[model samples]
Target chain A: MINIILNNRQESIDVDSMTVQELLNHKNFTFKLLVVKINGKLIKRDSYDEAVIRDGDEVTVLHLVSGG
Target chain B: MSEMIDTKIRQHLSRFRVGIAGCGGLGSNCGVALARVGIGELVIVDFDVVEKSNLNRQYYFLKQVGLPKTEALQHNISLIDPTVRITSHNTTIKSDNVAELFGGCDVVVEAFDRADQKVMLIESMSLLLPDTPLISGSGMAGWGNNHLIRCEQYGNLYVCGDQQTEVSPDVPPLAPRVGIVASMQANFVMEILMRKKV
Candidate 1:
Protein backbone atom coordinates (compact mmCIF):
# COMPACT_ATOMS: atom_id res chain seq x y z
CA MET A 1 0.00 0.00 0.00
CA ILE A 2 1.12 3.53 -0.80
CA ASN A 3 0.08 6.46 1.31
CA ILE A 4 0.23 9.68 -0.64
CA ILE A 5 -1.35 13.09 -0.75
CA LEU A 6 -3.48 13.78 -3.78
CA ASN A 7 -4.22 17.46 -4.15
CA ASN A 8 -4.44 18.16 -0.39
CA ARG A 9 -6.12 14.98 0.69
CA GLN A 10 -4.50 11.84 2.01
CA GLU A 11 -5.20 8.48 0.43
CA SER A 12 -3.85 4.97 0.71
CA ILE A 13 -3.67 3.21 -2.60
CA ASP A 14 -3.05 -0.44 -3.42
CA VAL A 15 0.08 0.07 -5.48
CA ASP A 16 3.43 0.66 -3.83
CA SER A 17 4.82 2.42 -6.90
CA MET A 18 3.48 3.82 -10.14
CA THR A 19 4.24 6.35 -12.84
CA VAL A 20 2.75 9.82 -12.70
CA GLN A 21 0.57 8.92 -15.65
CA GLU A 22 -0.72 5.86 -13.85
CA LEU A 23 -1.40 7.86 -10.71
CA LEU A 24 -3.38 10.36 -12.75
CA ASN A 25 -5.32 7.51 -14.28
CA HIS A 26 -5.96 5.91 -10.91
CA LYS A 27 -7.39 9.18 -9.63
CA ASN A 28 -9.43 9.69 -12.83
CA PHE A 29 -8.00 13.11 -13.61
CA THR A 30 -9.09 13.24 -17.26
CA PHE A 31 -8.65 16.97 -17.61
CA LYS A 32 -6.23 17.63 -20.46
CA LEU A 33 -4.67 20.81 -19.14
CA LEU A 34 -3.37 19.35 -15.93
CA VAL A 35 -0.14 20.32 -14.20
CA VAL A 36 1.39 17.60 -12.09
CA LYS A 37 3.88 18.04 -9.32
CA ILE A 38 5.60 15.55 -7.09
CA ASN A 39 7.09 16.65 -3.81
CA GLY A 40 7.20 20.27 -4.87
CA LYS A 41 8.80 19.54 -8.27
CA LEU A 42 6.95 19.88 -11.53
CA ILE A 43 6.53 16.84 -13.79
CA LYS A 44 6.34 18.00 -17.36
CA ARG A 45 3.73 16.41 -19.62
CA ASP A 46 6.27 14.40 -21.58
CA SER A 47 7.89 13.14 -18.40
CA TYR A 48 4.67 11.95 -16.82
CA ASP A 49 5.18 8.46 -18.17
CA GLU A 50 8.66 8.28 -16.68
CA ALA A 51 8.21 10.16 -13.41
CA VAL A 52 7.77 7.75 -10.53
CA ILE A 53 5.44 8.11 -7.56
CA ARG A 54 6.24 6.20 -4.45
CA ASP A 55 4.90 5.83 -0.92
CA GLY A 56 4.31 9.08 0.93
CA ASP A 57 5.01 11.26 -2.12
CA GLU A 58 3.03 14.45 -2.27
CA VAL A 59 1.43 14.45 -5.68
CA THR A 60 -0.47 17.40 -7.00
CA VAL A 61 -2.59 17.28 -10.14
CA LEU A 62 -4.01 20.72 -10.91
CA HIS A 63 -6.55 21.32 -13.68
CA LEU A 64 -5.91 24.85 -14.95
CA VAL A 65 -8.19 25.11 -17.94
CA SER A 66 -11.72 26.39 -18.38
CA GLY A 67 -11.28 28.32 -21.66
CA GLY A 68 -10.47 31.92 -22.49
CA MET B 1 -8.41 54.84 8.14
CA SER B 2 -10.53 53.49 5.30
CA GLU B 3 -9.62 56.42 3.08
CA MET B 4 -5.96 55.99 3.93
CA ILE B 5 -6.16 52.32 2.95
CA ASP B 6 -7.82 53.20 -0.34
CA THR B 7 -5.13 55.73 -1.09
CA LYS B 8 -2.40 53.23 -0.34
CA ILE B 9 -4.02 50.63 -2.56
CA ARG B 10 -4.26 53.12 -5.38
CA GLN B 11 -0.61 53.96 -4.97
CA HIS B 12 0.32 50.31 -5.12
CA LEU B 13 -1.84 49.70 -8.15
CA SER B 14 -0.35 52.62 -9.98
CA ARG B 15 3.17 51.25 -9.44
CA PHE B 16 2.42 47.68 -10.46
CA ARG B 17 2.85 46.01 -13.84
CA VAL B 18 0.78 43.08 -15.08
CA GLY B 19 1.09 40.75 -18.07
CA ILE B 20 -1.80 39.40 -20.10
CA ALA B 21 -0.98 36.41 -22.31
CA GLY B 22 -3.48 36.18 -25.16
CA CYS B 23 -5.82 39.12 -25.69
CA GLY B 24 -8.97 37.10 -26.09
CA GLY B 25 -12.08 36.76 -23.97
CA LEU B 26 -10.25 36.66 -20.64
CA GLY B 27 -7.19 38.75 -21.42
CA SER B 28 -9.01 41.65 -23.10
CA ASN B 29 -11.63 41.89 -20.38
CA CYS B 30 -9.13 41.48 -17.55
CA GLY B 31 -6.80 44.04 -19.04
CA VAL B 32 -9.61 46.56 -19.30
CA ALA B 33 -10.70 45.97 -15.71
CA LEU B 34 -7.15 46.40 -14.46
CA ALA B 35 -6.71 49.55 -16.53
CA ARG B 36 -9.97 50.98 -15.26
CA VAL B 37 -8.69 50.37 -11.74
CA GLY B 38 -5.49 52.26 -12.58
CA ILE B 39 -2.93 49.55 -12.98
CA GLY B 40 0.30 51.30 -14.00
CA GLU B 41 1.28 49.14 -16.97
CA LEU B 42 0.18 46.12 -18.96
CA VAL B 43 2.33 43.83 -21.15
CA ILE B 44 0.00 42.11 -23.57
CA VAL B 45 0.88 39.39 -26.13
CA ASP B 46 -1.30 37.77 -28.75
CA PHE B 47 -0.67 36.57 -32.27
CA ASP B 48 -4.15 36.56 -33.71
CA VAL B 49 -6.06 39.32 -35.39
CA VAL B 50 -9.49 40.39 -34.19
CA GLU B 51 -12.38 39.00 -36.20
CA LYS B 52 -16.13 39.57 -36.33
CA SER B 53 -16.68 36.54 -34.12
CA ASN B 54 -14.39 37.99 -31.44
CA LEU B 55 -16.74 40.93 -30.84
CA ASN B 56 -19.15 38.62 -29.04
CA ARG B 57 -16.93 38.33 -25.96
CA GLN B 58 -13.61 40.06 -26.62
CA TYR B 59 -13.17 43.70 -25.68
CA TYR B 60 -12.95 44.73 -29.31
CA PHE B 61 -15.12 46.81 -31.61
CA LEU B 62 -16.30 45.94 -35.11
CA LYS B 63 -14.07 48.65 -36.54
CA GLN B 64 -10.99 46.94 -35.10
CA VAL B 65 -11.75 43.55 -36.63
CA GLY B 66 -8.67 43.43 -38.85
CA LEU B 67 -6.29 44.67 -36.18
CA PRO B 68 -4.06 42.44 -34.08
CA LYS B 69 -5.70 41.50 -30.80
CA THR B 70 -2.83 42.91 -28.74
CA GLU B 71 -3.04 46.25 -30.51
CA ALA B 72 -6.80 46.42 -30.30
CA LEU B 73 -6.76 45.66 -26.58
CA GLN B 74 -4.09 48.25 -25.97
CA HIS B 75 -6.12 50.87 -27.78
CA ASN B 76 -9.23 49.93 -25.85
CA ILE B 77 -7.44 50.00 -22.50
CA SER B 78 -5.90 53.38 -23.30
CA LEU B 79 -9.36 54.81 -23.82
CA ILE B 80 -10.18 53.79 -20.27
CA ASP B 81 -7.01 55.23 -18.71
CA PRO B 82 -4.60 57.29 -20.75
CA THR B 83 -1.96 57.11 -18.04
CA VAL B 84 -1.84 53.32 -18.10
CA ARG B 85 1.21 52.36 -20.09
CA ILE B 86 0.74 49.36 -22.39
CA THR B 87 3.31 47.34 -24.33
CA SER B 88 1.58 45.17 -26.89
CA HIS B 89 3.26 42.18 -28.55
CA ASN B 90 1.82 40.86 -31.78
CA THR B 91 3.19 37.36 -31.31
CA THR B 92 2.42 34.01 -29.85
CA ILE B 93 3.36 33.20 -26.25
CA LYS B 94 5.30 29.98 -25.97
CA SER B 95 6.97 28.14 -23.07
CA ASP B 96 10.55 29.11 -23.87
CA ASN B 97 9.80 32.83 -23.94
CA VAL B 98 7.50 33.14 -20.94
CA ALA B 99 10.21 34.56 -18.76
CA GLU B 100 11.58 36.86 -21.40
CA LEU B 101 8.14 38.35 -22.04
CA PHE B 102 6.59 38.56 -18.56
CA GLY B 103 9.57 38.22 -16.24
CA GLY B 104 9.17 41.67 -14.73
CA CYS B 105 5.45 41.58 -14.22
CA ASP B 106 4.01 41.48 -10.71
CA VAL B 107 1.42 38.98 -11.94
CA VAL B 108 0.45 37.35 -15.24
CA VAL B 109 -2.99 36.38 -16.54
CA GLU B 110 -3.11 33.27 -18.71
CA ALA B 111 -6.06 33.89 -21.01
CA PHE B 112 -5.58 31.42 -23.83
CA ASP B 113 -8.61 29.68 -25.34
CA ARG B 114 -7.25 26.23 -26.03
CA ALA B 115 -6.36 23.68 -23.37
CA ASP B 116 -2.89 23.12 -24.81
CA GLN B 117 -2.16 26.83 -24.78
CA LYS B 118 -3.39 27.21 -21.23
CA VAL B 119 -1.19 24.36 -20.07
CA MET B 120 1.80 25.81 -21.85
CA LEU B 121 1.47 29.19 -20.18
CA ILE B 122 0.66 27.81 -16.75
CA GLU B 123 3.54 25.39 -16.73
CA SER B 124 6.02 27.83 -18.18
CA MET B 125 5.05 30.68 -15.89
CA SER B 126 5.04 28.43 -12.86
CA LEU B 127 8.62 27.44 -13.64
CA LEU B 128 10.12 30.60 -15.11
CA LEU B 129 8.34 33.18 -12.98
CA PRO B 130 8.41 31.22 -9.78
CA ASP B 131 7.72 34.27 -7.67
CA THR B 132 4.97 35.77 -9.78
CA PRO B 133 1.42 34.47 -9.62
CA LEU B 134 -0.37 33.30 -12.78
CA ILE B 135 -4.13 33.84 -12.72
CA SER B 136 -6.00 31.76 -15.31
CA GLY B 137 -9.55 31.10 -16.49
CA SER B 138 -11.06 27.66 -16.85
CA GLY B 139 -14.58 26.23 -17.39
CA MET B 140 -16.49 29.46 -18.12
CA ALA B 141 -18.55 28.27 -21.02
CA GLY B 142 -22.33 29.06 -21.03
CA TRP B 143 -23.75 31.06 -18.06
CA GLY B 144 -25.63 31.30 -14.74
CA ASN B 145 -23.33 29.48 -12.35
CA ASN B 146 -22.17 32.64 -10.66
CA HIS B 147 -21.82 30.73 -7.43
CA LEU B 148 -19.68 28.03 -9.02
CA ILE B 149 -17.18 30.43 -10.53
CA ARG B 150 -14.39 30.66 -7.98
CA CYS B 151 -10.61 30.95 -7.64
CA GLU B 152 -8.40 28.05 -6.68
CA GLN B 153 -4.76 28.53 -5.80
CA TYR B 154 -1.93 26.09 -6.33
CA GLY B 155 1.42 27.47 -5.26
CA ASN B 156 2.04 30.50 -7.46
CA LEU B 157 -0.80 29.59 -9.81
CA TYR B 158 -4.38 30.84 -9.50
CA VAL B 159 -7.15 29.36 -11.62
CA CYS B 160 -10.56 31.07 -11.90
CA GLY B 161 -13.51 29.22 -13.37
CA ASP B 162 -16.09 26.50 -12.69
CA GLN B 163 -13.24 23.95 -13.26
CA GLN B 164 -15.49 21.80 -15.44
CA THR B 165 -17.16 23.78 -18.21
CA GLU B 166 -15.43 23.03 -21.50
CA VAL B 167 -16.18 25.21 -24.50
CA SER B 168 -18.00 23.21 -27.14
CA PRO B 169 -20.70 23.56 -29.76
CA ASP B 170 -23.30 23.13 -27.02
CA VAL B 171 -21.57 25.05 -24.26
CA PRO B 172 -19.95 28.04 -25.88
CA PRO B 173 -18.08 30.87 -24.21
CA LEU B 174 -20.56 33.67 -23.61
CA ALA B 175 -20.02 37.17 -22.33
CA PRO B 176 -21.65 36.95 -18.93
CA ARG B 177 -19.74 33.98 -17.56
CA VAL B 178 -16.51 34.87 -19.28
CA GLY B 179 -16.72 38.37 -17.86
CA ILE B 180 -17.41 37.00 -14.42
CA VAL B 181 -14.29 34.85 -14.43
CA ALA B 182 -12.18 37.54 -16.07
CA SER B 183 -13.33 40.10 -13.52
CA MET B 184 -12.44 37.65 -10.77
CA GLN B 185 -8.99 37.22 -12.28
CA ALA B 186 -8.53 40.98 -12.41
CA ASN B 187 -9.80 41.31 -8.87
CA PHE B 188 -7.36 38.67 -7.70
CA VAL B 189 -4.52 40.60 -9.31
CA MET B 190 -5.56 43.64 -7.27
CA GLU B 191 -5.62 41.53 -4.14
CA ILE B 192 -2.13 40.21 -4.86
CA LEU B 193 -0.77 43.65 -5.62
CA MET B 194 -2.28 45.13 -2.46
CA ARG B 195 -1.01 42.30 -0.32
CA LYS B 196 2.48 42.64 -1.78
CA LYS B 197 2.55 46.25 -0.68
CA VAL B 198 1.80 45.20 2.88
Candidate 2:
Protein backbone atom coordinates (compact mmCIF):
# COMPACT_ATOMS: atom_id res chain seq x y z
CA MET A 1 0.00 0.00 0.00
CA ILE A 2 1.01 3.59 -0.58
CA ASN A 3 -0.17 6.91 0.77
CA ILE A 4 -1.03 9.90 -1.45
CA ILE A 5 -3.05 13.05 -1.33
CA LEU A 6 -5.94 12.92 -3.79
CA ASN A 7 -7.40 16.37 -4.51
CA ASN A 8 -5.97 17.65 -1.22
CA ARG A 9 -7.24 14.71 0.86
CA GLN A 10 -5.06 11.93 2.18
CA GLU A 11 -5.77 8.35 1.15
CA SER A 12 -4.03 4.99 1.04
CA ILE A 13 -4.19 2.72 -1.96
CA ASP A 14 -2.69 -0.52 -3.20
CA VAL A 15 0.73 -0.06 -4.78
CA ASP A 16 0.77 -3.00 -7.21
CA SER A 17 2.00 -1.71 -10.58
CA MET A 18 0.14 1.52 -9.90
CA THR A 19 0.40 4.18 -12.55
CA VAL A 20 -1.39 7.49 -12.94
CA GLN A 21 -3.63 5.94 -15.60
CA GLU A 22 -4.58 3.06 -13.36
CA LEU A 23 -5.13 5.34 -10.41
CA LEU A 24 -7.43 7.58 -12.49
CA ASN A 25 -9.48 4.64 -13.71
CA HIS A 26 -9.56 3.11 -10.25
CA LYS A 27 -11.01 6.34 -8.86
CA ASN A 28 -13.50 6.61 -11.76
CA PHE A 29 -12.82 10.17 -12.83
CA THR A 30 -15.25 10.51 -15.74
CA PHE A 31 -14.23 13.98 -16.80
CA LYS A 32 -12.26 14.06 -20.05
CA LEU A 33 -10.49 17.39 -19.47
CA LEU A 34 -8.32 16.71 -16.46
CA VAL A 35 -5.05 18.26 -15.25
CA VAL A 36 -3.07 15.55 -13.47
CA LYS A 37 -0.11 16.39 -11.30
CA ILE A 38 2.02 14.31 -8.99
CA ASN A 39 4.12 16.14 -6.42
CA GLY A 40 3.44 19.37 -8.36
CA LYS A 41 4.80 18.05 -11.67
CA LEU A 42 2.33 18.00 -14.55
CA ILE A 43 1.61 14.59 -16.11
CA LYS A 44 0.62 15.25 -19.67
CA ARG A 45 -2.08 13.12 -21.28
CA ASP A 46 0.37 11.01 -23.29
CA SER A 47 2.44 10.04 -20.25
CA TYR A 48 -0.47 8.98 -18.06
CA ASP A 49 0.13 5.37 -18.92
CA GLU A 50 3.78 5.52 -17.93
CA ALA A 51 3.75 8.00 -15.03
CA VAL A 52 4.08 6.03 -11.86
CA ILE A 53 2.55 7.02 -8.54
CA ARG A 54 4.74 6.62 -5.50
CA ASP A 55 4.00 6.56 -1.80
CA GLY A 56 3.48 9.96 -0.14
CA ASP A 57 3.16 11.66 -3.49
CA GLU A 58 0.87 14.62 -3.52
CA VAL A 59 -1.54 14.17 -6.41
CA THR A 60 -3.79 16.92 -7.65
CA VAL A 61 -6.51 16.09 -10.18
CA LEU A 62 -8.17 19.25 -11.43
CA HIS A 63 -11.01 19.41 -13.92
CA LEU A 64 -11.10 22.17 -16.56
CA VAL A 65 -14.72 22.16 -17.60
CA SER A 66 -15.95 24.28 -20.54
CA GLY A 67 -17.06 27.47 -18.88
CA GLY A 68 -15.46 30.78 -17.99
CA MET B 1 -6.35 58.30 -9.81
CA SER B 2 -3.28 58.92 -7.70
CA GLU B 3 -5.50 58.62 -4.62
CA MET B 4 -6.37 55.08 -5.67
CA ILE B 5 -2.92 53.91 -6.77
CA ASP B 6 0.33 55.70 -6.11
CA THR B 7 1.79 57.48 -9.15
CA LYS B 8 4.93 55.37 -8.99
CA ILE B 9 2.97 52.14 -9.01
CA ARG B 10 0.71 53.42 -11.78
CA GLN B 11 3.73 54.36 -13.84
CA HIS B 12 5.25 50.94 -13.30
CA LEU B 13 1.95 49.23 -14.22
CA SER B 14 1.96 50.92 -17.63
CA ARG B 15 5.04 48.96 -18.62
CA PHE B 16 3.55 45.46 -18.06
CA ARG B 17 2.12 43.27 -20.81
CA VAL B 18 -0.69 40.85 -19.98
CA GLY B 19 -1.92 38.11 -22.28
CA ILE B 20 -5.35 36.67 -21.65
CA ALA B 21 -6.24 33.21 -23.03
CA GLY B 22 -10.06 33.35 -22.97
CA CYS B 23 -12.47 36.25 -23.41
CA GLY B 24 -15.53 35.03 -21.65
CA GLY B 25 -16.39 35.83 -18.06
CA LEU B 26 -12.93 35.44 -16.60
CA GLY B 27 -10.89 36.85 -19.47
CA SER B 28 -13.08 39.86 -20.18
CA ASN B 29 -13.55 40.76 -16.54
CA CYS B 30 -9.87 40.36 -15.77
CA GLY B 31 -8.91 42.47 -18.76
CA VAL B 32 -11.25 45.22 -17.67
CA ALA B 33 -9.69 45.31 -14.21
CA LEU B 34 -6.17 45.48 -15.61
CA ALA B 35 -7.14 48.11 -18.16
CA ARG B 36 -8.77 50.28 -15.50
CA VAL B 37 -5.57 50.11 -13.50
CA GLY B 38 -3.69 51.20 -16.67
CA ILE B 39 -1.76 48.04 -17.54
CA GLY B 40 0.09 49.01 -20.71
CA GLU B 41 -0.63 46.24 -23.19
CA LEU B 42 -3.06 43.33 -23.47
CA VAL B 43 -3.12 40.46 -25.91
CA ILE B 44 -6.72 39.19 -25.80
CA VAL B 45 -7.07 35.76 -27.44
CA ASP B 46 -10.38 34.05 -28.08
CA PHE B 47 -12.17 32.63 -31.10
CA ASP B 48 -15.71 32.75 -29.79
CA VAL B 49 -18.27 35.50 -30.16
CA VAL B 50 -20.60 37.31 -27.85
CA GLU B 51 -24.10 35.90 -27.58
CA LYS B 52 -27.24 36.95 -25.76
CA SER B 53 -26.29 34.51 -23.04
CA ASN B 54 -22.90 36.13 -22.52
CA LEU B 55 -24.51 39.37 -21.36
CA ASN B 56 -24.79 37.87 -17.91
CA ARG B 57 -21.04 38.09 -17.35
CA GLN B 58 -18.75 38.68 -20.36
CA TYR B 59 -17.77 42.15 -21.47
CA TYR B 60 -19.55 43.03 -24.66
CA PHE B 61 -22.14 45.40 -26.08
CA LEU B 62 -25.51 44.13 -27.28
CA LYS B 63 -24.69 45.42 -30.75
CA GLN B 64 -21.36 43.61 -30.67
CA VAL B 65 -22.94 40.18 -30.35
CA GLY B 66 -21.72 38.83 -33.68
CA LEU B 67 -18.21 40.23 -33.26
CA PRO B 68 -15.45 37.85 -32.25
CA LYS B 69 -14.73 37.87 -28.53
CA THR B 70 -11.19 39.08 -29.09
CA GLU B 71 -12.40 42.06 -31.13
CA ALA B 72 -15.25 42.93 -28.81
CA LEU B 73 -13.11 42.71 -25.70
CA GLN B 74 -10.42 44.87 -27.27
CA HIS B 75 -12.99 47.51 -28.08
CA ASN B 76 -14.32 47.39 -24.53
CA ILE B 77 -10.87 47.55 -22.95
CA SER B 78 -10.05 50.58 -25.08
CA LEU B 79 -13.08 52.26 -23.65
CA ILE B 80 -11.66 51.78 -20.16
CA ASP B 81 -8.20 53.06 -21.09
CA PRO B 82 -7.58 54.32 -24.59
CA THR B 83 -3.85 54.20 -24.00
CA VAL B 84 -3.92 50.42 -23.51
CA ARG B 85 -2.26 48.80 -26.53
CA ILE B 86 -4.63 45.94 -27.31
CA THR B 87 -4.00 43.04 -29.68
CA SER B 88 -6.82 40.65 -30.49
CA HIS B 89 -6.13 37.15 -31.79
CA ASN B 90 -9.01 35.32 -33.38
CA THR B 91 -7.44 31.88 -33.43
CA THR B 92 -7.51 28.59 -31.60
CA ILE B 93 -4.68 28.04 -29.13
CA LYS B 94 -2.95 24.70 -28.72
CA SER B 95 0.06 23.65 -26.71
CA ASP B 96 2.29 23.89 -29.76
CA ASN B 97 1.25 27.47 -30.53
CA VAL B 98 0.55 29.08 -27.13
CA ALA B 99 4.14 30.00 -26.47
CA GLU B 100 4.48 31.54 -29.90
CA LEU B 101 1.21 33.40 -29.46
CA PHE B 102 2.09 34.72 -26.02
CA GLY B 103 5.85 34.95 -26.09
CA GLY B 104 6.05 38.68 -25.54
CA CYS B 105 3.75 38.68 -22.55
CA ASP B 106 5.32 39.36 -19.18
CA VAL B 107 2.43 37.56 -17.43
CA VAL B 108 0.12 35.16 -19.23
CA VAL B 109 -3.36 34.73 -17.80
CA GLU B 110 -5.21 31.44 -18.30
CA ALA B 111 -8.77 32.58 -18.93
CA PHE B 112 -9.86 29.55 -20.89
CA ASP B 113 -13.17 27.80 -20.35
CA ARG B 114 -12.05 24.24 -20.97
CA ALA B 115 -9.86 22.25 -18.62
CA ASP B 116 -7.55 20.98 -21.33
CA GLN B 117 -6.73 24.45 -22.65
CA LYS B 118 -5.99 25.74 -19.17
CA VAL B 119 -3.64 22.87 -18.48
CA MET B 120 -2.06 23.18 -21.91
CA LEU B 121 -1.42 26.90 -21.45
CA ILE B 122 0.14 26.28 -18.05
CA GLU B 123 2.29 23.39 -19.23
CA SER B 124 3.33 25.03 -22.47
CA MET B 125 4.24 28.32 -20.81
CA SER B 126 6.14 26.49 -18.10
CA LEU B 127 8.22 24.88 -20.80
CA LEU B 128 8.54 27.93 -23.06
CA LEU B 129 8.63 30.76 -20.55
CA PRO B 130 9.47 29.30 -17.17
CA ASP B 131 10.09 32.62 -15.50
CA THR B 132 6.80 34.22 -16.61
CA PRO B 133 4.04 34.14 -14.03
CA LEU B 134 0.91 32.26 -15.05
CA ILE B 135 -2.36 33.22 -13.38
CA SER B 136 -5.35 30.87 -13.70
CA GLY B 137 -8.80 30.21 -12.31
CA SER B 138 -10.48 27.14 -10.83
CA GLY B 139 -13.51 26.21 -8.64
CA MET B 140 -15.46 29.43 -9.03
CA ALA B 141 -18.88 28.24 -9.97
CA GLY B 142 -22.25 29.53 -8.83
CA TRP B 143 -22.59 31.97 -5.92
CA GLY B 144 -19.91 30.62 -3.65
CA ASN B 145 -18.56 31.92 -0.37
CA ASN B 146 -16.97 35.07 -1.80
CA HIS B 147 -14.35 34.98 0.92
CA LEU B 148 -13.19 31.60 -0.36
CA ILE B 149 -12.25 33.35 -3.60
CA ARG B 150 -8.72 34.08 -2.54
CA CYS B 151 -5.32 33.86 -4.22
CA GLU B 152 -2.97 30.87 -4.03
CA GLN B 153 0.47 30.55 -5.58
CA TYR B 154 2.22 27.40 -6.67
CA GLY B 155 5.68 28.06 -8.05
CA ASN B 156 5.14 30.66 -10.79
CA LEU B 157 1.40 30.02 -11.02
CA TYR B 158 -1.11 32.10 -9.13
CA VAL B 159 -4.80 31.14 -9.06
CA CYS B 160 -7.82 32.91 -7.59
CA GLY B 161 -11.05 31.04 -6.96
CA ASP B 162 -12.70 28.65 -4.52
CA GLN B 163 -10.60 25.76 -5.98
CA GLN B 164 -13.30 23.08 -5.99
CA THR B 165 -16.65 24.64 -6.79
CA GLU B 166 -17.98 24.32 -10.32
CA VAL B 167 -20.68 25.94 -12.42
CA SER B 168 -23.63 24.08 -13.83
CA PRO B 169 -26.80 25.06 -15.65
CA ASP B 170 -28.61 25.07 -12.35
CA VAL B 171 -25.80 26.98 -10.66
CA PRO B 172 -24.48 29.40 -13.22
CA PRO B 173 -21.38 31.58 -12.88
CA LEU B 174 -23.06 34.64 -11.42
CA ALA B 175 -21.78 38.17 -12.03
CA PRO B 176 -20.54 39.09 -8.57
CA ARG B 177 -18.70 35.82 -7.92
CA VAL B 178 -17.00 35.73 -11.31
CA GLY B 179 -16.04 39.42 -11.13
CA ILE B 180 -14.49 38.95 -7.69
CA VAL B 181 -12.25 36.13 -8.91
CA ALA B 182 -11.28 38.13 -12.00
CA SER B 183 -10.43 41.11 -9.82
CA MET B 184 -8.32 38.94 -7.56
CA GLN B 185 -6.44 37.58 -10.58
CA ALA B 186 -5.72 41.16 -11.69
CA ASN B 187 -4.56 42.06 -8.17
CA PHE B 188 -2.02 39.25 -8.34
CA VAL B 189 -0.70 40.67 -11.60
CA MET B 190 -0.17 44.09 -10.01
CA GLU B 191 1.51 42.58 -6.97
CA ILE B 192 3.92 40.68 -9.17
CA LEU B 193 4.64 43.80 -11.21
CA MET B 194 5.29 45.85 -8.07
CA ARG B 195 7.48 43.14 -6.51
CA LYS B 196 5.17 43.01 -3.51
CA LYS B 197 4.68 39.65 -1.81
CA VAL B 198 0.96 39.86 -1.11
Task: List per-prediction Cα lDDT, in the order shown.
Answer: 0.87, 0.82
Candidate 1 vs. true structure, TM-score:
0.91
Tens-place lDDT per residue, model 1, A1-68, is 99998876898999879999998888788877788888867899899999999999988788765568
DockQ of each: 0.66, 0.39
Chain B TM-score, candidates in order: 0.95, 0.93
Pick out the ten consecutive residues of candidate 2 chain A with the lowest summed lDDT. Answer: A59-68
The worst-scoring run of ten residues by lDDT in candidate 1 chain B lies at B3-12
Clashing pairs for predicted structure model 2, backbone only: A64-B115
Which consecutive 10 residues in model 2 chain B have the weakest lDDT in total? B1-10
Looking at model 1 chain A, which ten-residue stretch has the lowest summed lDDT?
A59-68
* Runs in model 2 lying further than 4 Å from the true structure: A1-18, A21-31, A53-60, B1-5, B196-198
